[model samples]
Target: MKKNNTFFYLCTLLITVFLFITFTTIFSYFMLREGNKASAIKEFEVKEQEITLKTRDKLKIRVYRTKTKTIEEMDIEEYIKGVVAAEMPAEFNIEALKAQAVAARTYALAHMESVGGNGCGQINEGDICDTVHCQAYISKEDRFKAWPESKGNEYWSKIEEAVLKTKEEVIVYNNSIAKDIYYFAVSGGKTESSEEVFSQSVPYLQSVESTGEEVAPKFTSSLRYTNANFVKMINSYYPNSITSSSNLKNNIKIKNRTSAGGVKELQIGKTTITGTKFRSIMGLNSTNFSFVFNGNTVEIICKGYGHGVGMSQWGANSLGKNGKDYKYIISHYYKGVQIGKYTEL
Candidate 1:
């Protein structure tokens, strides 16, 4: 009888063990499937790209990701001929493009979760739609394969070098590792400070004295309009002078308005103007803003693109199209800078 009971117990134990294994397997399979689905949604890369690290002001500059996947869809032969024909100087040998692809891939891998210019994690699409820090994808026509003709290049080796450290440096920028070396874009050929205008800092950047060119100093009213936002900007530098609740008739007036090309003509009170001169007055640049016009009210509009300082994006693209490489293009606008390996940092 005892022997029979032992056999019965053994059978029950084996059956329970087998059932447990079956249940666990099913659960694990479903869990893995869900995990893969999430990755497919959140993970993507710039096909065949490399990256470098840079620091500015107190902030570490994040690798600028192209929202347009120019690599994945590129037809090397056609792309090469298009660039060469445009009289834009580009070296399109199979080897060179392969190198670019390697570099691009390296950079993309390095920047998977890197920090941004604002000392925050790298932002994706829709984060800074109109801002220059992140490039926006204008259309589906944006995709271009990096190197379908050739595999890749030598630069891929360097992609991983500065990425991790570069991310670390960005945190420092947010915490004030480097003093902020902020600048105004063109200053509209001449410029002044909110401190000068309103006797305060206005939370804005410093202007580089005047360049005297009609297109030299780029000033923007991109973030400031109306009575409330204007007050915040003024108060950012000269808080005592501006009040957020004040209306136009009580504390604001349009002064010395000037108009510029290919932009909307705006009339608020007595003056007519174009460009970002309005932002300079209001103390915003691609970041924060507020505007209240008439009883109906209108939101602030950006007059000029970018920070409005030394170089313009459209200007750089034009130069690139007219025979300029990355180095020449970057240096022309930045002035007196070295594009060295980030490893030195």
Candidate 2:
């Protein structure tokens, strides 16, 4: 009987040990599975957050196609790619291309009708137009066609990389994106102040020296017209003011100049007009110009390629080539500004 009891006790002890081991193994397996599930959930959340941030940064814009007279909505990043491709030379430095991309983005955002701003004035149905009146935009196909076949792909890849690297970046002033971030082809050695160019004062659009524009092609242009043709053109616009070429020669004068050396007030026969107006009427390349009337022809010499306001494209390229980054280039031209991500606003 004692031997039988000992056997029963040993069996009971063995069964208890086996049951404990089984329970501990099952518990550990379940804990590991739960831990893995939690880890996966956390990773998924992180990915979702990343996706949300990307979506927020994706800006949409309405573009008006001048050729088709149609309005199409597109991603602002893509629009900026087109604008940078069309506006800046593909051969420009990557930093210069990036600067152009930011300026173009800021300009577009500032003029967005959905943000309580006026459209680009080229169309009623779109926020901006694909012309110089707003921003020059070129389709991918047209851009490729504009370049040499040998260099087209390579150049386009550079522009695309620039645009993507600086994606969602814009210039900001006073806690807001600059609305009138005007830019031009050249500056005639100096940029003009806002008040000097547009008759409206903007603190950020201050006058600044722009070097290296002299190296640009077409930096200087001369328009020469016969005295008779000059008089006819002036009279056609002014109407019955200049009776003869002599009257025009004597009456035409530069009344004053802006601080940046741009023509300010131009005196004509019995009418004084701003240099801005004169540029528009005469189709001059820029307001930074001089005029000389000789015996037979009137020669108008322009120093720059566009209105001497805000950033200069050639100047930016020069700066970039001289080891300046895009941020420095932007801040140099636009006084008292900061570079920030658009989504931050």
Candidate 3:
């Protein structure tokens, strides 16, 4: 009887051990399979999210935010959208906005350092800045805050569409990314050549007719400065240039005019200054300006708003209103340039 009882106990112990091993194997197999399935699902979701937000040109740009004093990395397309929104008026025609989008993209690509061009030298780690020195950029939140409550979304959507439509388009010259891609607010009925404004003769940045900009707000602006103040300001920049304010008309004369009707040089007393420099010193609107002396106060009238080089924003709007497409406007302003994808070289 004792032997039979011991045999039964041993058999029961062996059966329990076998069952435990079997159960553990089955549980581990199912757990592993479920874990793998969950991982696969998570990976697919991540890829889908990437596909939703990722642009074809995944190039990143590092911008130094002047207000926040932080370097922010963003996709190039997003940067262009912000630039177009901040640079051009949201009320501008869609075609003009699209041209601005392309111009901004070309400028950014030309200055990008990751692709072998020099980045913005203002900061070490940044490719550009959120200022006019590089390109004005406004954050979506700030842009929305500045817009009317009802029109914020509508305006932003328009800018986004402009950028999306002109994706990856850049101005090129001779099968290469063009240099000195510039754009400004207004022109003096015609665009200035790169040689006249920047002192370099770029083939693509030649003089072109830019009519219909008279409707712009600052197309004809005037600023008054007392004779004494004008002489003081000019002397401050070019010391001892003008001796007195009595013979101001004779002392300050425009030496030559540019092809586009802007002042090329000005003779102020013994100092001969370029119109560009004088404009900066006197805080005038543009190089295309004239002075009127009424015995005491000198009123400087300017016919444009910016340097008068490259594309004119107001002119572009006029062209767009006249049924010109973005491509036509771009080609009109920038001569001999091809609109295409940016060349890496």
Candidate 4:
């Protein structure tokens, strides 16, 4: 009897000890796995910059200007999304980048009707150019097995939060703050005039002005004629900027004039072409310059896309590959002032 009782007690104690050990081992394994996962997230070296707001709120946002990483090397669409997300850094978060992507993509989709050379493709749409006039898009073959953004739970959550917060201003060429946007151009190096800027019209140098600057034409290109949807879309941007097809003149002669804005007045001798002809003869890249003749309105065919503003997109792609950041990229093309944020301005 004594032996039986002792044997039973030993068995129960051993079983209890085994079960305790098993539970502890499983818990330890899980804890270690979670710890490693957290560590891995921390390992990612995402840098950020801080700024003071107009309302005195301080913000810290991640900086995506990777020197060695090209758009091809990284998911460029995601990078751009982050650029516009206007997110300040927080704890273990990658969703803000996607949130910005949705908004940016929305903006792009909405304005896709604009000229090819416009928007994110412009020279200086706020702080981005996509080229020398701006920054750049990711080229082909670089988008390998990468984590691009999507409108998933994480994406939607972040976007909803970002949208509700302060909306980043839609930037335009010449640092123009817009309700939305008027025009965007895919810049090369320096933004040329309409013929150059829109029509890809090469300049014919007439003479060097007294300022030692070669002064030829405010607009050296012909009014780009296009019946394309983008041409028709220009009306929405500059409601006053576009004119009728009657702007086309038969005996049109163009001469450069310096005024509040060059190409201000288009004069065929002295009968100033004030309406659509004014825009046409002056070669100003406005909707008014479009002309209708014999059932076909002369639509100025915009060649290269964009505002022809600051940094060119292609130019930046070349430079970024050659090693440049947002700061170096902007300074190389745009003259004057150092590379610094506009802060509250």
Candidate 5:
């Protein structure tokens, strides 16, 4: 009987050891599975946080204030409102204002690396400046001060409506924001091709006829300067080349003209300067100019204003007044571009 009891005890001990081993293995498997699940959850949270941060950056714009020498960060849409108010005239048609809003929004996005750019850190760690160098921007208070007290509310409401209507809309070419969306006050009967004006070939900025720009206030301007003054001006640009009025008249000639009738190349003594450069130096309204030097006086006739490239604000206003919608206006100026909402960076 004692021998039987000993064998039974041995069997019981063996069963206990096997059960312990099995339980331990099962517990270890479950712990490893739980640990993996926790790791996956943590990774997902990190990805979610990264996306949120990116979205926040994309939604905001950093503006550099030139006067105050400071940086201001604000919502992109709000920034657009300020730009539209400052860039376009308050009396402009609502559709034209909307078009300006879209263009400004596209320009801002194109300059921001977080949104999609090489990064336009123009000033003070900001994406853009509040001057014409980037885009003219006025704060709410300044905008109010710019207009008459009675018209301030009305104009501000009008601009706000336009901006909100075209919120987040941008001009896109080939599934990306257009690199350049240039706009000027007026065109000289025709818009200039980008290659002619900026010396850069942009496929979307081809020359196109823009009528009704004659309605602009300064469509044509005449600058009368004495031969002595003309020579002085030219000499400022090309020093010591033109000593006398007769020398200036003899050396100054148009070497080449663009297809749109704007000056392409001009010869100033020995140096050949671009028509755009000449216009800038002479303070002419546009590159489409003609000069006549008659003995003692020189008179320069300039047509239109600004660079004469891209959309003409005056032309846009005319089209808008004629019942053309903003889409039609933008499409007419920018060739073969899609107006689409930006869904992502």
Candidate 6:
């Protein structure tokens, strides 16, 4: 009995010691994992803070003045003010102007050589041009010359305010400055995707609903051409496409429409062309168009203006009037984009 009791005590001691050792090992492993997780989180926070802190800098740009045929250096913020003034109407909602300001800044930085971008191809030694080829820019003298005396100063001050309020803000996608920043006057009722218009599949430049653009001056327009004249025009661009003007209605057919309801392809006699090419050949405002054959006269009615890609200025104004902020306006037009300080390239 004594021997059995001693053996039992020894067995209990060994079991307890083994259990303690196992528990200690498990606890140590969990503690080490938690510590590693905490370290990783702290490191991420530090990197984010560094990105924020490094955003402050005074940047400059070289602009190619088409009128003077010269390359002039200017402060980037001042250039943005000029761009906002030239690109958007001063009478528009303030929030809309702010959105335009951000877009202009992003566009400028995208072509600026100082920011690791390829300079404009239109110029040999400049960041960008002061024309619609790159972006329209009006100097103080030219702005005053263009605007009425009473409105020039007030309008310029408003544009300056818009630029100052959204200083250095840029549209970023996938952690980089977006290069395809295109804007237009109107979108009819919807904006077009980049793939449909420019043949480039961009993630953020996808089609979306853009309402309240009917108030824009260029929302709807019409061009009239006689049947004979229309045939001449089509033949001028695409030689001998239209042979007969008697059955003009049967000769022309809309091949297909885009996702946003813009004409994607059109069949005119023997020639089938993209809607954009047709718009160019026919002098239409946009690809969203329809024609009516009234007797011998053909009237083409067009909706929207410009390329119909990216943000719509009038649409932004409408959203701003409806109490949407600039950030909201930008996010609505540019899908899945982040607005922040100018990204370091």
Clashing pairs in 3: none
Worst 10 residues of 1 by lDDT: 169-178
Candidate 1 CA-lDDT value: 0.35
Worst 10 residues of 6 by lDDT: 47-56
lDDT of each: 0.35, 0.85, 0.87, 0.34, 0.84, 0.87
Better of 4 and 5 by TM-score: 5
How does candidate 6 score on lDDT? 0.87
Model 2 worst lDDT run, 10 consecutive residues: 46-55
lDDT of 3: 0.87
List CA RMSD, all candidates: 21.7, 15.5, 22.1, 21.9, 18.2, 9.0
What's the TM-score of every candidate structure? 0.28, 0.81, 0.81, 0.30, 0.81, 0.83
Per-residue lDDT of candidate 3, residues 288-316 (tens digit): 99989898899999998988889999999
RMSD of 2: 15.5
User: Which order, best to worst by lDDT?
Assistant: 6, 3, 2, 5, 1, 4
- Writing each residue's lDDT as its tens digit, candidate 4 over 180-234 gives 2112223312343334223332222111111111121222234534433323444
At residue 124, candidate 1 shows an lDDT of 45
Best by TM-score: 6
Model 6, range 114-229, lDDT digits (tens) per residue? 76677788889989999988889988777788888999889988888888888778887877778888898898799999999999999999999999999888999999989999
| Residue lDDT tens for model 1, 190-211 | 2333343333453322333333
The residue-level lDDT of candidate 6 at 299 comes to 89
Give the residue spans of candidate 6 off by over 4 A: 1-58, 343-345
